[model samples]
Target chain A: MGEKVLMKGNEAVAEAAIRAGCRLYFAYPITPQSELIEYMSRMMPKVNGTFVQAESEIAAINMVYGAAGCGKRVMTSSSSPGISLKMEGISYIAGAELPAVIINVQRGGPGLGDIQPAQGDYFQATKGGGHGDYRLIVLAPSTVQEFADMAGSAFELADKYRNPVMILSDGLLGQMMEPVDFKPHKTEEELEELGKQHYDWCMHPNEDEPNHHHHEINSLEIDPLVLEKHVIHLGEKYDEIEKNEIRYEEYNISDDNDVLVVAFGTAARIVKSAIDELQEEGKSVGMIRPITVWPYPYKAIADRITSKIKKVVVFELNLGQMVEDVKLAVNGKIPVEFLGKVGGILFTPEEAKTKILENI
Target chain B: MEVIAQRPKSLRDIQFTYCPGCTHGISHRLIAESIDELGLRNKMMGVAPVGCSVFAYKFFNFDMAEAAHGRAPALATGMKRARPEMHVFTYQGDGDLAAIGTAEIIHAANRGEHISVFFVNNAIYGMTGGQMAPTTLPGMKTSTSPYGRDEKDIGYPITACEMLSSLKAPYFIERVSLLSPKEIIKAKKVVKKSLQFNKENRGFTFVEFVSTCPTNWGLDPIKARDWARENMFPYFPVKNFRDKSLNGGE
Candidate 1:
């Protein structure tokens, strides 16, 4: 039986990371996500784990890069602006094919926007924030419970693919309190076994075993041919991920429904609330929430679109990023409406309901 | 069966990539020797910084992670925390640690992370063709600071040992030079002690070695040593800034 306790989304992420055998956590204190780092700081000591308040987001991300390079489960948390500072290291981690978890408890911004919840970083998180042809497995958690659950799944996916996985939540998810049950903790021995099976590229100590070779973890290759080859290999891995890891949730989509609301993260939560109100008022409205933003539940959305859904509305906290993907999914069969607020203004359930009614 | 007067067992047979007269080789040997002496060869992991020592992972036989410039301390913090049973350290150069990664190193020390940091301050960015580094003396000229580093424009050289010593959490902080053979011996002792502290699961230990860049300084190896002593030492003095062990009137 799973035990449930009331916890904030940020606290649940921290607790789940610990339970998933994450012993190294480094982060800089930023609003919204500060609670996550604070929780880790208080909890890491009790579990014989380590929590470091890094000097900056750049430092924190690099710290994750280091721990990941050594075949250890590690994580770092930040808001939008802080995550921006970490882009360089994130690109490096992706290039080196290191498995690490990065949590972006997104707040507003192209700059120091605001502390309010915003999904403006969707393009950045899903489309590679840094300069590279790399894709992070971006997970969007609609509820506090999923935030806890995804922490373990994120680590598992990272280790499996040797790629960085980002939990792309917004300030609402980071700040909201809800019931959550922590996963069972994995023993050190179990983690060691897992690490050995997956991370042969890791820098484990080379002693006694003469056949053991040193591994150099670097993302640099001046040779264009070699770089092209490396990128191709990464491309193949991405394709494999796309085929195997697409996840999404369809809520109340049926042949009777005409307008379909598309959303993710916090926007999805608002959309769900709107859907309930719309259904109560005798309006046919439904929502589709994309859990994995990169592997992007395209198939599910396309399947729904084929079943007589006419109008689609994409709601986001950005000017229009995820709408493009929605359009691609709809393939001109339906008109895609975009309702967005940039620089940290979140859409309210009433506002979404109003938009849905107008569209209908 | 006693192993003495020989190289550390922790070090591999790989030849160092550092240029001749580069103090990084000596510094690396000192760290490896310390790891060996403490019987931490098998349990030690190191984060190698970018710049001249970027390829340090190839030199160290133990597990090593290569980090971007200035991020070594942050990386070391993660590794040390993730596997407390393993000893962790970061080998960094002036440009990597003092310039870009200043925040990471300072905060990690301030947090009193159970890791050792071996900082090599050569006064110039050697790997990147003699760019002026944070540790470069005020009047020193480099590729970037062609008109000699003007204090008014570039600010004064950062004395890392002095800076870190001011932090409360760091347990050991020392500035040593590797100019002469005698100084090399002293530098090795400091490096060893810092590693030993980490092996003993003590708090943050920092050893700043006043290193040299013969190729970048456009000086021959001997002249570079002489130049470092005449110019760099006066600005960045070599001394023990803090030692928790010496707090008791020893």
Candidate 2:
């Protein structure tokens, strides 16, 4: 176990990735996420690893694709617009069933939106941003500590499922400072053994073996029937993940509570602060923070949304994108309200508290 | 011993779904032969770009990755850096590399990633039913350029070798023709040497193979080769734009 240290959220993510056995990092510098790339560039050389400043966001994602193909632990980081540029590569990685870690320190969007913190990319992260029938396991972190801890879990899930894993945070998480306890690093030998066992599709030379046959890594199938079969297999895997990997946290949700606040990532942090304030003011309000956005804890919300809960408020940085999922989870048994900010501006705890009070 | 006529040892035995006379088969064979000769069959990982070659993952016997169009070079960069012990390369077409992937290729070369690039220039989009390509010569007719490629409107062809040679980081840049037996022989040598350089841990290497599209060009295979040699070659000339080995020898 490494000593606990105070670090910014972006810095913690970079440190956590290094500790998780990731050595190959390719990224292009984008605001909000620049510190993560810079940290890797400095640390990789010291660790005898490789860090490359890619030409563009497109190149960075593709480089990640290449590294992942070789059965190595790899990662990349970028801001909102840059992550949008990476969507095509992200789709390919998911389609090919390759394990890779991608971090999106989200900012305002729509087109070069803003460098400020925003959760506007919730839909793009959970939904298939690129063209295809595929899903990336989206992990949303609300605190710096969660940001550090989830990096290892993200890589583990990526390898376990042979899929892409995204750490969906925002500029506030990237910029804010907090305490973090570093995880133990996996040894090179351990990683090599893991790669050998799990990365059967990787390109390692077959030597002194006549029975060894060639393996291909591709996502193209011209025939509709063949493509459909492949898609069905992926769907089965996604279902399995949904059953096993759904994660969330409930704070002070009781039968007596009349309002439930649902949020994720940075918005959840603000919502938590708001909940604290409302509780101080003696209001019956509770919060639910989603940790995994894709394999959402829908059943948990549904089970809790009994007749006692009068309303559910969905707060995000986007224009009511995640509100749709919240409505589905609540099943319209109660009214759903939305409070959102767009183009990179983040909602404050004070603002959330005001919205909750207004609903009450 | 009876010789078996099949795919090369470096290539999987899976039958390619390419149309008859499609140059992708020839290009794949050349690449496989190069890997086999260089004894890099085990250490080689290929990045397959979108377009017709999206299934390049199925053909190569080595470990392969499928990348979105124009992103193969970027993927190759990451793969090579992650596993420097392995040789990384990307197989891309004109549309994937020259058009949509233009930014990827330029930066990969500029960064001097220790990888090789096998760029197949067939002028027209083969997978998408003959659309206009960035390397499509002016005045050439295609589904998208039905009125012919107007230089005043669509711009002239992009010479990848010449464009890449301008980058100081690249160690080698060559443009070869794959239309004739002699040209095929020459192209194979270029391909082999590039892989050898990769095995030696040389810097970025790029090879552009000017190929033919008989079906897309609405011509016979023989005429397609002839048309390419006469039309495409003059515009996108065939030659070694840069070679560290040649410079060292000199």
Candidate 3:
């Protein structure tokens, strides 16, 4: 393990990405995530990497598309409104089937929302925020350390699937500081190997490999039949991803539990505290934290629905997003409920415990 | 028997989809020839915009990327910055570059990104049918302006070369015409020089081709060229706007 260092969540993500062999970083300044772009700006030059403060979020995402099309590991970051501006380019990246990473340190929003942490973009992130049939392997991290770890995982998943991956963080994680031990940075040879992984399709002169020429990195298939085949092919890949990559943490789960609390990210951390307090009171309550929100760990949730569990409750910063997923998992087997705080308001641990007690 | 003319090595053997007399074919040939002459066939990469040349990726024999409308410059910026050793260029039409992508083009030029831009100003959106364009001349009839473009309501055409040359970063900025054989010969030189400068890693080269759209113009190919010469030539006058090399490049 590398020596531990104190780093902000945003900064840790940036450092972890560099260690993961990302040499091309582009982004526009947005609140809560500005530190990430700032960190890249200061460090990219030192590592002989490129950092561009793009003119707009739209430009930054397209720049990511351009670089990733060339088989280089690239990243961009923004808050909510900025992310909305990036959806168009993100869709293009997905359609082109290029590996790129986007960090959305979410702020509250439907429009010009406040610069406070919020989980309102859950639907946008998990349900293919952009247009058309596609999915970004979305990773949700509950702690700063996990935020740092997920950076490496996000890039790997993106490259493996040849799809865009989003590290869905929020204002709390971005602003919080934590001690993180990043993995060893990739050596020059390893980075070179990473670069060559996409040589078969990357946009290059192909001078050394003569038979490969005119590799077109594009999403537009003019014929409807061809496009249908392509979309179905993408669906098959997504199925493979769902099969192999669903991740979640089951905490205090037992057959004696009366309530199965479902939450993620910040809400999950608060829920963990609530479960701890409940256990002290001789009350049996459990919690499930989803690490991958899209593949969703639905089967995991469904399998844990014991007869002793009277209800499944969901906690979120938004009104009720992930609750729907929990309901789908519970599938009428037990009563499902939702508790949330919006507009940047977070449910306190005491408040979470009270909610869980009421459900129990 | 000696071969008089052949397709450039940089161009694929497939037939062009351009309509008869449309200058996009000529422009593509010039670009392909430039890539061939400079021996950048293996090194050059192109970004095709979302217009008539949207299929340019199919015709070019090198690695290519098709960008979202008006976002080609931004994509080129990403590619060039990621791999500075490789040469990149964007092919955009009037609607894609001047109207929708104005910000991307201007900002990319302002940053002096090391990429070549080939702007085709045909004065109308061809693929989407005849609609008024940012480069559409005043009092010129288009589908969007069936009664001729009204100067009061629509405003005059944008001279891309003049506007881009206003920036300090571009190393070469020139507007060329392809209405006649002699003019096309001149345009070829500009295209080659632009690519050469790009190959040399000179920053931000731009070339605007004042071209003809015979199908949309409701004229035969020859008449369309004549009309462009009579109208567009006066508004978007052919000229060399900027050459930083001539003044000792930074």
Top-lDDT candidate index? 3
lDDT of 3 by residue, B63-148 (tens): 89999999999999999988887899999999999999998999999999999999999999999999999999889888899999
TM-score of 2: 0.94
Model 2, residue B149: distance off in Å is 1.8
List candidate 2 stretches off by more than 4 Å. A1-3, B1-7, B19-22
Regarding DockQ, does 1 or 3 come out ahead? Answer: 3
Please list all clashing residue pairs in model 2, or write none if there are none: A62-B74, A62-B75, A63-B74, A63-B75, A67-B79, A108-A344, A203-B63, A205-B42, B70-B101
Clashing pairs in 3: none
Model 2 per-residue lDDT tens digits across residues B1-250: 8876656788877888788777888889999988988888878888888888788888888677777778888878777777777888989999999999899899889988889999999999998899999998889899999999999997888888888988899988899988888889999999999988889988999999998888899999888888988898788889988888774631
For model 2, fnat equals 0.85
Of 1 and 3, the candidate ahead on lDDT is 3
- At residue A169, candidate 3 shows an lDDT of 95
Best-first order by DockQ: 3, 2, 1
Docking level for model 3: high
Candidate 3 stretches greater than 4 Å from native: A208-212, B248-250
Estimated TM-score for each candidate: 0.91, 0.94, 0.98
**lDDT by residue (tens digit), candidate 1, A57-132:** 8988987887788788889999999999999999999999999999999988879988999998989999888988
